[model samples]
Target: MSLGAAPAPGVLEERYARLPAHQREKLNRIADTRRRLDAAARGAYEALREAQDDLRRARAALREAEEHTTRRTGGTLSLRQPDGRVMEFPARPWPPPELAQRVQRLEADVARLHAEHAAASAPAGVTTRLYERLLEHLGLRDLA
Candidate 1:
């Protein structure tokens, strides 16, 4: 739309065009807020990824320590961890209910937040269905 031409019926674009000093300042503030929100969300997601990587490293360390203890001691891997807590590997593999529950909750939270972020980042007039489809691949749904 041209600056001189009238915008859609109740858009207030005409007024926005006229009040350069006031409206321009307001628009600038809005734009700055939007930019900051985007940056903050991006930072949050990056931090989350880093934390996930760290968690993976910790799990890898635990597994490696178990294997090393098993091979070196020629006995079942039962020893005190760095925190002075003894850990015993189960002989038969079994699902840990507590761990499973925590994992499920975290996955759900991540999915919800991801969906919300994607939706928020989308431009005005974008369809919610389209936004949701984008979230589907991330195993997410729109959230508050």
Candidate 2:
């Protein structure tokens, strides 16, 4: 660890090398952590997408319902939720209970995506493929 001597070959690579008895162990641990996170991110992203799709479909259905009601009732669509909140649609942004709940969930998911995307910047471009490769090298790819 002296500073006066010239650095040896593979010095930089050796810096990441594990101890004699712990060869590849630290790297293995890091890869495992990254893999877990990658799996969690994939799950979260999938859930977000599903929730978003659900929200879209719900909103579209509500719109059609409102249009149909307005046309039939002359701009008066009475929708009674299970909680007994009967309100006239085409008047406020909040239409159906399902749409409202899904929108809220979607908004939360967007916030999570923003946070995770910000926190997930890998200098080596840790993409899904890269993540899988790392797992493969660690002999844990099959678990993923």
Candidate 3:
């Protein structure tokens, strides 16, 4: 059996095509910006994950180094961290400088990427709402 005819163009596409060129341009710009923001959010999320993994490795290394230091010193290693958690690192010998720095850097990177991802993803939703409102205002809500 043959289907009678091809379906008509999408109602939304037809309605969108009827919009004035300037209005179409505006919508396209908003769409492009939303795409860019979404891409950035994804990139930032991946970066954050990598940074967190690096931080985890750095922390483990630091712990091992501290344990060794404690063993060598023949004393307990305990220090209160800025977050109020007591980190047991031989009080006598500090963490290897490079390991401590790497951990700090990774922590900062994770925090920054978290903020960036939030910022980038947030505007995508805002643009979507604005696009819907524009469509509604233009009497295209039903088509949308």
Candidate 4:
């Protein structure tokens, strides 16, 4: 067990297992927190992908609905607002506000999750390498 040499496989884990119970518990908690955070980041990415897909589907449906409405209404579309106002468009009618807002909300959600996911993902192995360096500097690597 040199001061800074890499421990053989299982040697480090053996040493870790020999640590005091409280210290082992703390290390386990730290590892668990990392796993949970990683899982949450993955979930956010999945949700972001789902939101993007929903936005695309919503836009496509809106286009299709608009075309259908135009054909059925002879280029005039009338929509009733929540405030009890009837609004009519003559040609290439605008989408109902609710429908438009649904797409907007999904787009916004995707954007937010994308930013969060990017922020959550640190460069891989950086923290692990840093911890290894710290342990070596402290001469703790000899514990193996």
Best by TM-score: 3
Compose the digit string of candidate 3's lDDT tens values, residues 1-144: 123454356966887889999988987887788788788889888988888898898899888665544233346665555465665544453666777788898999889988988988898889878877876787666533
Best-to-worst TM-score order: 3, 4, 2, 1
Which regions of candidate 3 fall more than 4 Å away from where they truly are? 1-9, 68-70, 74-92, 142-144
Global CA lDDT of candidate 1, please? 0.50
Candidate-wise lDDT, in order: 0.50, 0.57, 0.74, 0.67
Best by lDDT: 3
Model 4, TM vs. native:
0.58
TM value for model 1? 0.40
What is the C-alpha lDDT profile of model 1 across 27-78, one tens digit per residue? 5554556566677568667755655565566556556545434222333346
TM-score of each: 0.40, 0.46, 0.71, 0.58
User: In model 4, how large is the Cα lDDT of residue 85?
Assistant: 71
Query: After TM-score superposition, what is the CA distance of residue 36 in candidate 2 from its true location, in Å?
Result: 1.1
Stretches of candidate 2 off by over 4 Å are 1-19, 71-102, 109-144
**Candidate 2 C-alpha lDDT tens digits along 1-144:** 123555466653454443343535744565676767667667666766776676677668767666544322655556665565666755444455767777677778767765664455342245545555654565443423
Model 4 stretches astray by more than 4 angstroms? 1-9, 20-22, 66-93, 122-144
- Taking the tens digit of each residue's C-alpha lDDT, what string does model 4 give over 14-72? 77777778766755654555566677678878888888899999999888766554232
Give Cα distance to truth, residue 120, candidate 2, Å.
6.7
Instruction: Give the clash total for candidate 3.
Output: 0
* lDDT (C-alpha) at residue 4 in model 3: 44
